[model samples]
Target: MISKIIVSVLYFAVVFYLGYKGWQNTRKASDYMLAGRRMNPFVMAMSYGATFISTSAIIGFGGAAGLFGFSLLWLTVANVFIGIFLAMTVFGRRTRRMGLCLNCHTFPELLGRRFDSSFIQGFSGLIIFLFIPVYAAAVLIGISRMLEVSLNIPYDWALIGMTAILAVYVVTGGLKAVMYTDAFQGGIMMVMMIILLYYTYSALGGVTSAHQTLTDMAAMMPEKLQKGGMLGWTQGAKFGTPLWLVIYTTIIYGVGIGVLAQPQLAVRFMTVKSDKQLNRAVLFGGIFIPLMTGVAFIVGALSNAVFTARGGKIAIAQAGGNIDKIIPTYIEQVMPDWFAGLFLLGMFAAAMSTLSSQYHVGGTSLGRDVIERGLFKRVGTSAKASQIGVTVTILATLVWAWVLPESIIARATAFFFGLCAASFLPVYLLGLYWKGITKVAAKVSMVGGFAGSMLWLLFVHEKEAAGLGICQWLTGQPTLVSAATKGSWVWLLQWVDPNVVALPISFLLAVGVSLMTKPMRQEHLEQCWANF
Candidate 1:
């Protein structure tokens, strides 16, 4: 017990120390919000990679790997190629250049300035305000779960403690604190993950034995999992899942394409000082992200073998047969107390890193994007106003922390990622590359994506509706439509992937509106589209 307390206190102290150092560096609102537009590539890379992966990747997705076999590795690949590489090479340079030119601090400000519309800023802020809480809650739940498992603390106390610490640092120090602390925490995570992976494999008697044990365990699969297209890795077809579903839903579609539009991630580009920094960060981030995410997934799958050999279960006992707890359960059983404490700290670091970024991004959206543009613009751009914005943001996030729901961490994370992808990626991408994209087009696209995605997820998507508790209560049956749920046209459209539906809706709306409205002037177009 003393050891746990010591480890926990030491971890908190290190984070707070880093936060203090970052706080010392802040002299202006820009420094507090965007690291004064000057950050080293290595720090930027570690911050981005750490913020991107998080407890969601370690615990939530690790739990997924244990449940879903090796299918989750595809997400790591996406995180590297798409999230890191494509984002840095494709969007990073233009965003940094344009952001600098426009003197923009937040993503909504960039979009608003580029398109010449305060509406875009307001709309972008609205989306962030609505969706980010779900993501924040997801991270909070993940941290609480690990604390509950590792320190044997009550879940609510763990949640409150973690949330308070994160909020205090973020509220006091802003993005500088976030990035510096992320660098420190990211290091802990990388080292801890590597050690845990090595120890877990060693405990299982090495690679060959682990694979053989896993194969034998597959042979003893439960009747229920065998029905859900989860026939382990070897016997794929017996579970009624086609190759298309396996590749699309599990690999290509579910996580592979999902990383591109993560709002928490996209804002990182705006925080850097230059294209050169983004370029350098990309290489470091590419290598680091894959290593962290890949190791976590590999460890998760290998845990199945160890758990089965030890007569332990590999399925998720929570979330109604969902497979998200495999890693947490495995960690509790396999790791010794000391290493377990380190692993738990690493997990906490993961959760806190991501949660801090989410809250920062969300607060910026609410304070800078929404409130500043609409009602608070009259107050002027004084440091006092920025401070007030910061205070409001911290209070708003605290309310969310208090009211977060249970067992929705994974879904909530996925939902926000999807929302960002659907609403912002199309317009944001086009605004950078396509000179023909007029302000009208950008506004329409933003509205279309935001409204369309929300409507689809709320009313149409059976999975989302069911997860949100809207389906069962309305229909009296869990499915999309039923005899009891007669006016359910929205649920019927839920079959369409939001990316497929909303991306095109946003693109077409942007283009169609842009073409119909006045074309962008040559000078304006050249100014915005000059870099590429």
Candidate 2:
């Protein structure tokens, strides 16, 4: 117990020390916002991966793997292909170049400056400020739940304690501290994940043997899962089934493509000095991301085998049927005490790294993009506004963590990711590559995407629609598009991902409005397309 206490204390102290370092170094708004756009390759990549592969990935997505199967491995492939490689080369490089050209700091600021529209920046900032807390709350809930299970602490206290600690550094140190600690936390995550992978394979005799063991246990799947299209823990679900749609479209594709437009992830490109830094970071990000996400998913699926062999209800059931609690409960049972303690800190590292970045981006969006630039158009207010934004973010996160429903981390993460893609992906992609993108088009597209996504979530998508029940109450029906339930065309309204539905509308609106509208001022165009 004393040794565990000492290990935990040292870990916290190092994070605190990095926070102090970040505070000491953040001399101006640029340093605070973008690390003066001079962060090194290693820190940039590590911070990016750390921020991207978060507790939501480990605890939430991992829990989903416990329920779904190795089919979630598709997301790992997507994360690497899109999140790291394509993003760094295709998106990151362009974003960094355009950001430098416009001298923009935040993601919304980049769009606003690109199109020369305060509405674009302001509304985007507002969207981020409002929705990101739900996502941040997901990360907060993930790690806090882990601690609650492992340390025998109350969930509320664990949530509050972690949030308070993160708020101190993030609110004070800004982006520099967040990235500095992110890199440190990223290191902890890598080491612990590696150990976990080793032990998992070793315990089940080897990779092949363990996998064979899992594959042979398909008959053990719960009736609910089997009804929902589950085939096996190793093989995933059947094609075109409801569970297949949920796993593939909502979980995999929703988050997979959505990573490209995530405001928090996108802003990291602007943190580096050059495209060279982004390039160097890619290899590391590619490796780091798989280690974190792949290992989590693999472990989650294998855990079903672990618990089942011991004559239990699978991972989620072992954690009292809360999918989020699967990993924490399993970690305690499966690992030695010292390593389990180390892994707890790894969960902290995962949660804090992602949470700090989310708060920083949310704050910067509110403070810099929306207020200083968009609303007030004032100089020297960036830092103060960001501080206030950070406070609001903390409060919002706490509230959401307190109120969110079960199986939240996976759903919330996907919900926010898909929402961002629906809202920003069209504008961001068009703005970056196409000089034809007009201001009104950008504005219209953003609004359309956001509105479309909300309507779908309310009327069509089952999860939030089911939870909110607004659609049910208004229409006197369980779902808005009940064609399948009632055998009508209205079922078309249900089931499709918001991104699939919203992104296309956003693209068409952007292009249609751009074609009809007068072009942006030539000099604004010159500056935007300049130096690229």
Candidate 3:
């Protein structure tokens, strides 16, 4: 504990120094919001990667890997090739150029300017500001669990302390501080994850032997999971089963595609100076992301084997049935005390980097987009307004962390990602390349997508609907589809992600409505596309 405290203090000292540096450099609202649009490629890349892969990836989804097994690695592949590579190349260039053209400071601002509608910007901002805390709480829960298990801190205290520290740097230093600390945190995460993978494989003998042992434990899977379609640690789940749908649709498909539309991640494109910087950042991001998420999933799956070898129990069993506790419990019990201390710092870096960005984005969305631009007639970022927004976001996140149920990290993260994709992707993507996209279409698509996603979550998605109990309260059933259809074909709809349904719905609304509406003004389109 003494060593852990010392290491934590050293880490915080460096972080605070970086925060002070960012604050010192910030001169105007632009500096606070976009780092003067003069960021280094490496820092931008590392910050983006760190913010993208947080405790949600490490502790929340890592713990999911403990139960779901190697199938989760598909998410890493999608995260790299789709989330990092394609997002930076296909979307980053246009977003950066257009943001420059429109003098936009936030994602919603970019969209609103493109559509020439204040309502689009304000509504998008409101969505982000409201839903972001739920996602932030997922990261909060992850780090709090780490502190609770590894450092023996109370969960509530850990949550409060962590949030308070993050609120300071994020509110005062803004994007500059968030990115600097994120780069530093990203480096820590990479080193720790590499060490963890090496140690895990070494402890299990060799790579080949470790995999073989896990493969041989197929029969050891609980009957309940077997019925749910999980095969084993090494083998994949049975296709189209309940487990398979949850794994593929929600975890892989939802999050994989959803990353493209994340307002927090989207705004990073506007931080760099040029397309060249974005191109360079792509290489760094590609390398950094896999090291963070890939290692977590591998170690998480192998935890089951490690626990079973040491005791006669699996990972979830050792964690007292809470999936969120699996990774933290494994680290505390299995790894050396020194490594445990270092791992805690890595988790802190992971959680703080992501949470800081979330707060910054949420705050900007509320202050700059919703309040200053939407409610008032102001058209630029406001430091004072954003500071207030950050405070409220921190409080909202804390409340969510307090109220959310156990084993909720992965679900919450996926929920926000899916929601963003459904609501924003259609308009953002279409408005970028298509001059025919009208204001009415953009507004209709955004509203339709959001409504569709919520409807599915409330009435169709069994896991969420059952937990929310809204459907149960309204119709006396956990899910409307389940009650109406009986059990015969309920699995097909209940297990599908809201994104699969709502994204297409939103896209169709954008296209169909645009075809019927007048095109955007040629002068506005020319101005918006001037950089290109």
Give TM per candidate: 0.90, 0.98, 0.98
Candidate 1 Cα deviation (angstroms), residue 194: 1.0
Summarize candidate 1's per-residue lDDT along 107-178 as a digit string, tens digits.
Answer: 888888888777888788777866677667767777777787777888778876887788778877778899
How does model 3 fare in lDDT? 0.92
lDDT of 1 at 156: 75
**What shift in Å separates residue 131 of candidate 2 from its native position after superposition?**
0.7
Deviating ranges (above 4 Å) for candidate 1: 233-247, 250-255, 317-324, 374-376, 379-406, 469-496, 529-532
For TM-score, candidate 1 versus 2, the one ahead is 2
Candidate RMSDs in order: 3.6, 1.4, 1.2
Clashing pairs in 1: 460-494, 461-494
Error (Å) of candidate 2 at residue 7 is: 1.4
Q: List the residue pairs that clash in candidate 2.
A: 483-488, 483-491
User: Tens-digit lDDT track for model 2 on 1-532?
Assistant: 5666688789999999999999999988888889889887799888999999889999999999999989999999999999889889988988999999999989999999999988899899999999999999999999998888778889999988998999899999999999999999999999999999999888888999989999998998889999878999988898766688788888989999999999988888998877778889888987998999999999999998877766777787798989999998889887788887899889989999999999999999889978888865766798999989999999999999999988899999999999999899989998999998899999999999999999989988877887899988999766766636542335534556787788899889999999999888889888987877
Clashes of each: 2, 2, 0
Q: lDDT per residue, candidate 3, 125-233, as tens digits?
A: 9999999999999999999999999989999999999998998899999999999999999999999999999999998998998899899998988899999889998
User: Which residue pairs collide, candidate 3?
Assistant: none
Arrange candidates by TM-score, highest first: which order?
3, 2, 1
